[model samples]
Target: MGTFGRRLLLAVDAKGYGGADAVTQRQLQEAIRRLLSEAAAASGLEWERWETQVGGDSVFAVLPEGASEPDLVDTFMRHLDAGLRAFNHGRVRAAWLRLRAVVHFGSASPGAIGFVGRAPVEVGRMLDSAALKAALAAAPDACLALAVSPTVFNDVISDAYTTIRAQEFREVVVAEKEHTGRAWIRVPGYDARALDLGVPSGAGREGATGGGEVPDVRPPSAPTAPGDTVVQVINGTVHAPGSVFGISK
Candidate 1:
């Protein structure tokens, strides 16, 4: 007997978690737990009222009904950004906690271990999207990368009264494994408009790069292998050398 209803679903994952040593990974997991708790509290979300699940280096959270989307954006996201900034301020690059997040709204039900629903599955795909992973990798300075499903984008982010300006989000196509769909992306503190359309330096294919053109700030590094593609920052825009389509930003 599980109840069903419309809920706000969120998933957050740490980038490069697999590459870390065991001890460091454990520390990161704890940090993420604390970060989520702080973010939820700052956003006025009650911890006890929501269903939460933790896996490896990721978290899946379901917000109670009537949770304000705009508030989640303005408060939770901002607090998350601030928290990560503070955490990274004195740390080296290897210890910095970069994250990818996905937000959606859909039906869900409480299960034995956590919430079981299509919303969780969909948000997980968005979190694991290549577009998001590449975007975060390209912008080394960015602390968090976010993908919002079309439903959330249309209903919440695009609303006139939302604190998150619609212009801050850029449309992108997520093509990873079995998931192929459109999602909106935003990096809280960085200039989302300045990101280039490219995959991680070695990712095999190109996807949509939708934004204005900017100069590459950094030169392309030498590829490790003959067929390995190099990522080029042209005027401030990032580009994958072997990409079939080039989208400027």
Candidate 2:
């Protein structure tokens, strides 16, 4: 809320994978719900508008005026990432459970009178289709990726990471091009070192300065009623009672 018109458009998405079978069923709904609740709490920033769409796996929030900007983004991501891991502990397959996150930053503003334009929607679409999946594959641990728009790239990509080559994706290029429509430069404190890639708070894991191990994965179980999966989750681990049945048979 400074005289500066700069704002960050953060788009995020998460997915669950690998169970006895698609039907054996991981606690997808419960995981997503906890993700949203934790993100809202973690950000501690108001939203111009926030909503859950594209099923329950994804949630969108627009940072309101006076939000911490880059710092808020880092906080929100760390909060959600830690929450998911904590949510997965103690289950029969807890070690195998993981989540993927993709965040894109851009110049954004609410449509006059409060309608969302193509801005947030386009980012969400990219996240849904590619970035989210890529994060899962590229992330060494169940890591979170916070991508900066080219508009702010020079500001955030450190001299070290900037000189180093990074994988290229057409979607990333396109989004960056779109964001340059408005004149802007990177803001301070928006560099790669600022990214909090470590584990979540109080999760009992070591600091995430370096990446962690990649857990083993099994296929999802075959089809079963959602109601039949009695998801009991505490401290981030989901417990599905044995009667829940349909596990990868």
Candidate 3:
């Protein structure tokens, strides 16, 4: 029978995946899978204990109950960063990869395809968050942008025992068509200088792609539409519509 227990849910998607041709997309899909395996192993995660499902340019994984979030942050994410860097080295711009990740904790019920639960759904929504996408767009030098659910952040990441520091994370509200919640963002390669820089604007230019010299043909701007509402908190104060949140960029 399939097992049921609390699990750490993780989802990762490659940025700019749809822009690539089918053949390159397939190649990148395989490469992402390989990189995830290698990164999991290098992070000292017990690969045998993880239930993984892969799509064309994304992966969903459920880690055993005892899995460590601090380990995920300090080890798995770092390994992923290094692995992607190594993979992108000497590769053409089109073949390069930048990723977005989401982590959450919840119950998991095993299924034929893999585990199924609200955790997976929540993490996927977190992965698709506008805040996460904007953060990645803002930081051109980062290879990975991670968003952690409030449960994970409070229980694991904010714990004093964890190697990851609280200052490393920025709070963001994840609002989408299906889900709305609080999440924390962290980029492995971000520096103080990078945060002050404006979002890049152009194709095939520097600061267009995350990591290395790869050129991202996609413009580095967050998606915006007329009359769309954005809710965010800056410095312990909530800013909703008609406030600074609606300020024109």
Candidate 4:
């Protein structure tokens, strides 16, 4: 027997982070744990329990009923985002984590296998699939901010911020240390080196090793690419940077 409800499973990892493999992995794991605990308390969600897996780099938990409201999910997302930023600020430059977070909601069986439900394992798998595609399309230094399944997107996401959807996985070349492998995704006008090495040239595109793993080194380019600029909108109208970027609550 399985419960029929919107079960959410979130699994997160960073892209192109450069730090000790073990330490960086641990940091991500610990951050998730802390975030879950804090969010549960603040959101008043009845989180049953959580488990640390894969050397503290990943986690899984159950959300209490009534925690799936769109407004509440959005609020929780903002909270998680803020908490992650704070966690990175305390780490070294090389240790900063730009994460790929995937959230999946569906029916789940809490107990051991054999129950017919979308359990955390399946939800986590979906997130990983989405993250892999997003990460591959992302610039080397670019990390996926967050990903929500259609269930969450349609049900929980507010229609405020427009989502930039990347196409499904498309293979590409990745240059890495002592080896080269085929990667995927095509982010138009993306420059990995510019973001990672402060170089204008976009080179050495590669799949990310686990969080905090060192990437292949390349000579830094001379020129610096201009930052990507975009228009900010508010209340159904475009706003100035001061009004948008600097708007305070």
TM-score of every model versus the real structure: 0.75, 0.47, 0.72, 0.51
By how many angstroms RMSD does model 2 differ from the true structure?
17.8
Q: Write the per-residue lDDT of candidate 4 for residues 69-176, one digit (tens) a residue.
A: 452345555566667667776567566655555556667544442223543534443334433444434454332344454445433433333232223223222232
lDDT string for model 3 (138-175, tens) is 78767788888777777777764467776677655444
- Model 2 alpha-carbon drift over 4 Å, by segment: 1-7, 17-26, 47-54, 92-115, 129-132, 152-249
TM-score of 4: 0.51
Model 3: what TM-score?
Answer: 0.72
The candidate with the higher lDDT, 1 or 2, is: 1
Question: Please, what are the lDDT tens digits per residue for candidate 2 over residues 200-249?
Answer: 33322221333332221112431111111111111222221121111110
Candidate 1 shows a clash count of: 7
lDDT (CA) for every model shown? Answer: 0.66, 0.37, 0.65, 0.41
Give a tens-digit lDDT track for model 1, residues 45-77: 876676666667877777778887777766888
What's the true lDDT of residue 25 in model 3?
A: 89
Please tell me which model should have the higher lDDT, number 3 or number 4. 3
Those runs of model 1 whose alpha carbons end farther than 4 Å from true positions after fitting are 1-3, 111-114, 176-179, 199-249
- How many pairs collide in each candidate, listed in order? 7, 14, 0, 0
User: Per-residue lDDT for 80 in model 1?
Assistant: 87
Global CA lDDT computed for model 3: 0.65
Give the best candidate by TM-score.
Answer: 1
Candidate 1 yields a Cα-based lDDT of 0.66
Better of 1 and 2 by TM-score: 1
